[model samples]
Target: MISYVSRRLGTSLVLTVLVSMITFFLLSNSFDGVVRSILGTAATSATVQAKKAEMGMDRPVIVQYADWLFHAVRGDFGISYFTGQPVGTAVADHLTVTLSVVVTALLITTAISVVLGVLAASRGGVIDRLAQGASLFGYIVPNLLLAIGLVVVLAVELDWLPATGYTPFTENPGRWAASIVIPVIALTVGGVANLSAQIRGAMIGELRKDYVRTLRTRGLSPGSIVLRHALRNAAGPAFTVLSLEFIGMLGGALIIENVFALPGIGSYSFSAALQGDVPIIMGLSLFGVLFVVGVNLVVDVVNGWLNPKARIQ
Candidate 1:
């Protein structure tokens, strides 16, 4: 298990560095227009050149990347040209909100997918068909549509929730939870649609195995056999699908945040891109890459423990 974790950690670190380097390279190259965005079209060439030199953009690309990486490692991700605030501070400010929504969405998706998947697999007949059909429909709808529709029906029409906004849990837990219902549902529905079907398929395959019948023959309860035995075998593939979903929550949040008027890393990244704020864009990108990799590492450790045979692979 230790070796498995170390291996996964090493791989994750390498991927993070590669992503950082690629992001830095792409951003650095596009920075010719960045100075203009920062200084305006009215600025003279000499002034722009001076600004570049002052900002160290004139340095060798590798050197620039090294310095940026060093500062980023120390939580000093430079200043956003558009916001005039430290890049780290800007991202940090919004990270909590973004994470709150994503984690909530994930928890909802997991609980729902597991139950629906297991039920559909175990029950078969109409339940199985309904679960599959629901999954297909959920997977097909765009999240943007889901957000707008939920807001209109639940928030605007029925007055059941706020139409568009966010309040921190620290301010008011009820309001915060209320504020996120539409967004969480939007994310959860799609995830449940996709993940539950995968779990159902995995579970169905597991249920047919010889050991499942043996457990039944030994007088094991159907629930025990399914939950303790079948679910574990089914979990491996479901977990793989869910990992991609987890990574996607960050990217998905951008659209959901926009439609809901929520302030989050997604909104920040969109603003950064619009303004050509290279530092903020790079900072957010790097942070996202690290977050995805970190989540995958934890998943790997959990998978290793759940199925020790997975460690060798």
Candidate 2:
């Protein structure tokens, strides 16, 4: 297990570095524009050149990347070209809002998917058909459309929740929950659609194995057999689906945040891109890559725990 974890960790670190390097180079290609955006178009050519030298853009791309990476390791992501805010501070502030919604949606997705998947797999009739049908609808509908419909029904028409704008949880937990509900629902529908289907299929396969018949022959209760053995065996695939869902949710949050008027990393990144704020864009890229790598690591560890054979693999 220790070796498995070490290997996964090493691989994650390498991937993170590679992603950062690629992102840095890609964004560096537009450094002249970023500098001009920072210094303003009215600035003279010498002024722009001076700004580039001051910011070390005059150096080779590799050296600039190494310097940025060095500072980034210490949590200093430089300053935003437009806002003049520290990149780390800006990203961190918005990241909390994004995480609050995305993480809540993930928890809800997992619970609902598990219940629906287990029931559909075990019951195999009307319940199964209904679960599959619901999953199909969710899969087909885009999150943006779902979010708009939800806002119209739940907020504008019914007035059950806020239509837009975020309230910090520190200010009012209740309002914070209200602010995120529509966004979370929008994010969760597709995740549940994908994960529940995967879980149902995996559970069905697990339940058909010879060991399940033996467990029944030995008089194990249906619930006990399903929960203890079949579910545990099926969890590996579910976790894989969940990891993919998390990555998807992060991307979805970008659009959902804008739709709901939530001040999240998604909105921040979008504005940064429009303004050609390279530092903030690079900071967001690093955070996203690291976030994904970390989640993948967690999923691997959980898979290993649920299936010892996974550790060897």
Residue pairs clashing, model 1: none
Cα error, candidate 1, residue 226 (Å):
1.6
lDDT of 1 by residue, 36-112 (tens): 88888998989989999988899998999999889888888898787689987888889988989999999999998
Tens-digit lDDT string for candidate 2 (77-105): 99987778999889889999999999999
- Return the lDDT, model 2, position 46: 92
User: Who wins the TM-score comparison?
Assistant: 2
Worst 10 residues of 2 by lDDT: 31-40
**C-alpha lDDT (0 to 100) for residue 255 of candidate 2:** 95
What TM value does model 1 have?
Answer: 0.93
Q: What RMSD, rounded to one decimal, does every model reach?
A: 1.8, 1.6
Runs with alpha carbons beyond 4 Å of true place in candidate 1: 306-309
